[model samples]
Structures are given as C-alpha cells and as structure tokens.
Target: MLRAQDLMTENVIAVTKDTEVRELALILTENKISGVPVIDGTGKLIGVVTESDLIFQNKKVHIPTAVAILDAFFFLESPEKMEQEMKKMSGVTVGDIYAPEVISVQKDTPLDELATLMAEKNIHTLPVLDKEELVGVIGKSDIIRTIAEGR
Candidate 1:
C-alpha cells in the first residue's frame, strides 16, 4: 500500500518562531507553498503556520454584543473572543499567529489514513515524522499530483 514515505517531500521549507511576517509571506509566495512547519533551535516541530493565518491579519475584529438592561450591561458574547481576534490581527511574527497544536503522521502511515486525517481536519499541510523526528512533509498538492500521475 502507498504510504506517507512514498509521496512525501523530503526537502521541506520551514520557518522558525522568530521569522517575521513579511518574510513568511515572501517565503510562501516564492516557494508557491500554502504553509510551513515551525521548528525550534533543536529542529523539533512546534507549530504550523499557514496562509490562512496570514490572511487572518486582514480579518475584521468582531466586537462582542452587549445588551444594556436596567442600567446594567450584559455581554451576550465572550469578550475574550474579541481580544483573541485583536491579538491575531496585530501579529507581527509567525510566533504570534502560528498554530501551536500540530497534527503529524508517521512515515509508515497509509495513504488512506493520511488523506482522511487531512480531510477531516481541513489541513492543507502535514508533517511526517519518524519516532518524533521530522522525516518529510506532505501537502495537499502531493496527493493531487499523485492522482494526476496515477500513482
């Protein structure tokens, strides 16, 4: 059966938390990739930053609704949500917007399981690991390319 190791890209383009937003955008555009894995000084995967995260910078912040009743204001929505949005909108570096929770696959993971995980999670890029070591990377394009080549 086809596995992650069969189709994954061995040479991966990645970023660090200290990477600036402008540089991240340029990397994405120049490399023609939608996202990249964020690694630390030790080369350990810590997060995933995507185009969606960068796009979020332009998203309008939604103010929480408050209902004024009897001279008392009661917020109908959580104000924390608005605070989070504001923080995301003001992000200047990958560390400010990258998703810390990452989903990874093993080298031996079957294609069906890999596809299912990506589909279910709505993930465009995934890190492939072997015993907690990054081995390769697999993106949606890889799967589509495989189908096109009838692999």
Candidate 2:
C-alpha cells in the first residue's frame, strides 16, 4: 500500500511566522497551491496557513449572541470563536492567522488512513514528519493524482 512518504512532495514550500500575508498570497497564487506550512527559525513546523485563512480576512464576522441575566452576561455562542474570527479578519502576517493546531501525519502512515483523515477533517494540505523532522507535504491534488493513477 502507498504511504505518506511515497506520495508526499519532498520539496515543500514553507514559510516563517514573520512572513507577510501578502507575500504568502503571492506564493500560493504563483505556485497554484492551497496552503503552506509555517516553520520556526530552527526549521521546526509550527503551523499552517491556507487559502481559507486568507479568505477569512474578507469574510463578514458573526457576532456572538449574549443576554444579560440580572447583573451577569451569558453568551449564547462562543465568544472565543468570535474573537478568533476577528483576529483572522484583521491579520497582517502568517503568524496572526495560521492554524497552530496542525493535523499532521507520519511518513509511514498508510494512504487510506491519510485519505480518511483529510476527508473527515476537511483538510487540503497535510505535513508529513519523520521522527519530529519535517520530511514532506501531501496535498489534495496528490491524493487525486494517486486515485487517477489507480495506486
């Protein structure tokens, strides 16, 4: 069975947290990619920045509903969710909007498992790691190609 190492793109295009959002947009446009991994100064994967995150900047924010009960205020919706949306809308750098809770996979992970994870999580890009080291990246396109190739 094909594994993440067999399908992942070794020459990954990654960015640092300090990378400007504008530059990231340009990279994605030019490379025709949906997302890129964010790394630290030591080249450790930190997060991921995606087209969806960039689009969030232009989306309308949904305010959390609240009600005043006596002297206390009760939020009908998650205020933290609203705050996160607001931050993403006003973000200027990859660090400001990148998803830190990364959904990554190991190099030896089976393609079937990878596909299931991507489908269930609605993820377009997944980073592959080898013993805590970034090895490659797998995108939705790669999976599609694999399917087309009947692999």
Of the candidates shown, which would achieve the greatest lDDT relative to the real structure? 2
Model 2 lowest lDDT segment of ten: 56-65
lDDT of 2 by residue, 95-151 (tens): 999999999999999999999999999999899999789999999999999999998
Candidate 1 residues 79-139, lDDT tens each?
A: 8887878887899999999999999999999999989999999999899999888889999
Question: Which residues of candidate 2, in runs, are more than 4 Å off?
Answer: none
Best by TM-score: 1
Candidate 1 residues lying further than 4 Å off, grouped into runs, are: none
lDDT of candidate 2 at residue 116, scale 0 to 100? 99
Q: Itemize residue pairs with steric clashes in candidate 1.
A: none
